[model samples]
Target: MKRFLSLALCASMLVASASAVSAKTYKMKIHSTGNERNQSTPPLRQFAKTVEEKTNGDVKVTIHFNGVLGGDRQATEGMQLGTIECGITTTSTLGTFDPRFNVFDLPFLFKDYETAYKAMDGELGDMLEKACLDQGLRILAWGVNGFRSISNSRKPIDVPADLGGLKIRCMENQLHVSTFKALGANPTPMSFSELYTALSQGTVDGQDNPPILTFSAKFYEVQKYYSLTRHVFSVAPLVMSENFFQRLPKEYQDVVLAAGKQYEADVRAATENLEAETIAELEKTSMKVNSINDENHKLFVEATAPIYEEAEKLVGKDIVDVARSCLNN
Candidate 1:
């Protein structure tokens, strides 16, 4: 009877210990609009793994991709509402959350990856991040979305005039809408989740995205033209709910921030490595690919000059000047 009682006590203690460990674990949900296989999602998965390993399984992360949780805008809003723990959203979408971020959305704002990263890692990034924090988002790291290009079923876009009257799907940002409007294209703001179907059904003529997204989302299957517009170099932030982040233990919070920094490097590397390969894959499809010549590119730059003025009015001229300074420096 004594032996049996001792064994039972040990078993009960083990069960109680297991329950305690489970209770101590923190659960985080990360939302993404892209599919599981996209360039952005894999790095996010690595981030989750690193966070778990570093935290010794005290922090559990679950990634919801393919708009499973919601679109970028919805995910960011969820983070604000404290319903979502984390998510990926473009700076363009974030402009709605804090208009100061709209400066990144201006046409031809960033010339290359180097310029964009410089801007984000320096003064401009600091200012914008603080603005986001005020709006209830804690930006953990900045990742690449690649330079955006135009894809359509209508025709090849060799010049700004090529965009006239074409119904293009744009992100829900005033700058993007204003950009397409200036090009004479009718820009329709739509959710990322609804984009593929809208294209397949002929609801919109064409859309713009990084070549990586164009290939990953299979936009090539529905669209017949791919133009190397490289108009906007897009960057996305891996963001956490300020409320959720603040609730984490200090040690776990530090782990999360470090993991996010690693994620930024991983995502940037993935995007750069896949960019040429993705464009090559697109070329192998039915889509007609074209690039603008220097002269025509100048025309595009000239055509969108008014966007800077509009951007200044929206994001403040001081911030706009600061972004331009990034290019000069």
Candidate 2:
């Protein structure tokens, strides 16, 4: 018995030593369209720092901000093809890869940050992450794109009717288009890169985005009204190429995954903190900001309620049911 125990201990030590000695150095890039001043950028930088420190320099991480590599879709495709190591992309972009992600595009699915986090960190996120893995992408952590609001040059949107006849630039997603149509706005699906020019030239009357984006992207420079619609809550996930993630040593994989969770916490906190500050900054600019009152908020909610049925069909009843359950809890 003593000899058997001694052999087991020896084997464990040998394996641990071998793992330490055989650690491989890996260099990886994390791509994001957000620039240096974007609210999520600093947390992402810290995420890279933590990854490098935890791995004892065995893993080197470099971040390419401002879409140096490509837009969200391009970067996502690159990762899926194993040409890009990692990236952070909106669920809308991921929706194209897997239609289940379109669930996020549903209007008013999340009414607040806490509810949003609970759903994404719970079964809704787990199921979506698993579905994405089957498509060659692995979701490390789900983060926020903040709740989207409408900003138009025309007027303050106190109610659904206020958006009537406005040409709102929306993401190239069917649900978004359908939602805008329901709200009585003309949903012009356009590339984000052309938004500034379009808004400047009045090609589109306005656009809906998170307040931080309206400030960071300087959309306020062209538009006059900013309403706290908080219409749709968007999520961005830090994703890695499944192939690259699998290629890592188990210990390094653990480090990277932990770093991803840290990134989620850091970025989410940063977003929550920056939101009020971003709004204050917007208020200081030429933009007029307003919030939808409880009565008006209800009106907005009721206006888009029909989208839920469409959402169920688009992403399956189970996903929509689970997401609604998360919010109710």
Candidate 3:
């Protein structure tokens, strides 16, 4: 009887040790709406790999790409609810949570990639991240999506007047709608999942997006012209649930945040270099690529100026001032 009791105690101790090991292992789900080959995908994959390596595989990240789980907005909602751990989505999509995100949608806000990067990596970025935290989401890093340009089946858009009467599909952001309206296009906010069908069925005459997006999504198949408007420099945000992040061990948290910064660098490099290549590829598909001259671009700038004012009211004048200073500096 003494021997049997000792054996039973040993078995119980082994089970407890196994349970403790299991508790230390964490698996996180990350969702993205882009394809596997997208510019954002490489960095995201790298982030996962780095985190696993840094943590010695204590933390694992599983990515769901091409909207497998749901669209961007839905994925964000999932993150907030703690149903999903992380997501990489556009600022426009995230505007649904905080209208302050719409500030990025202000037309011609970013002069070039360099200026935009400085703003995102500096104080303005910190402010935006804090705003997300207040809403129960942690902003891991700012990911790049490149500059947004117009693509259409009807005609080339070189200036604000050319966009007149064009029905353009935009993300569900108030600033996007206002900017498109200012540019003379009839803006219709639609979900990204339904945009392809809407464009193919002539429900929308045009849409604006980055070259990588147009090529990867095959928007060139239905579109005839690609205009280099570079109206809005877009940013993709890597976000995690604040609740989930707080629950992580300090060492695991450090691994994840460091990985996020590295991923941002990879994403920016990939997105910037791929634009010219992707545009060249799209041209081979019979899409006429048009570059807007500086004179005409000034007209577009003027038309969308009111959008900045509206956004200032929503975010704050100080934030807008800082962004403007970034542009000037």
TM-score winner among the candidates? 2
Which runs of model 2 end up more than 4 angstroms from their true locations? 1-23
State residue 37's C-alpha deviation in candidate 1, in Å: 1.6
Predicted structure 3: lDDT? 0.88
Model 3: residues >4 Å from true position, as ranges?
1-23
lDDT of 1: 0.90
Clashes of each: 0, 0, 0
Q: What lDDT score belongs to each candidate, Candidate 1 first?
A: 0.90, 0.91, 0.88
Model 1 misplaced stretches (Cα beyond 4 Å): 1-23
TM per candidate comes to 0.89, 0.92, 0.91
List, residue by residue over 1-329, the lDDT tens digit for candidate 2: 99999999999999999897767678888999998888789889988999899889988899999899999999999999998999999999999988899998888888789989988988888899899999999998898879999999999999999999999999999999999999999999999989999999999999999988889899999999999999899799999999999988898899999999998999999898888899999999999999989999989889998988988888889898987785567
Better of 1 and 2 by TM-score: 2
Residue-pair clashes, model 2? 0
In candidate 3, position 167 carries an lDDT of: 97
Cα lDDT of model 1 by residue, 1-329, tens digit? 99999999999999999898656978899998877668887899999999999999888889898778977888888999999999998887888767888888888877778888888898998998899999999999998889999999989999999999999999888889999999999999997779999999999999999999889889999999999999888888899999999988898999999999999999998998899889988999999899889899888989988988888889999999998786566
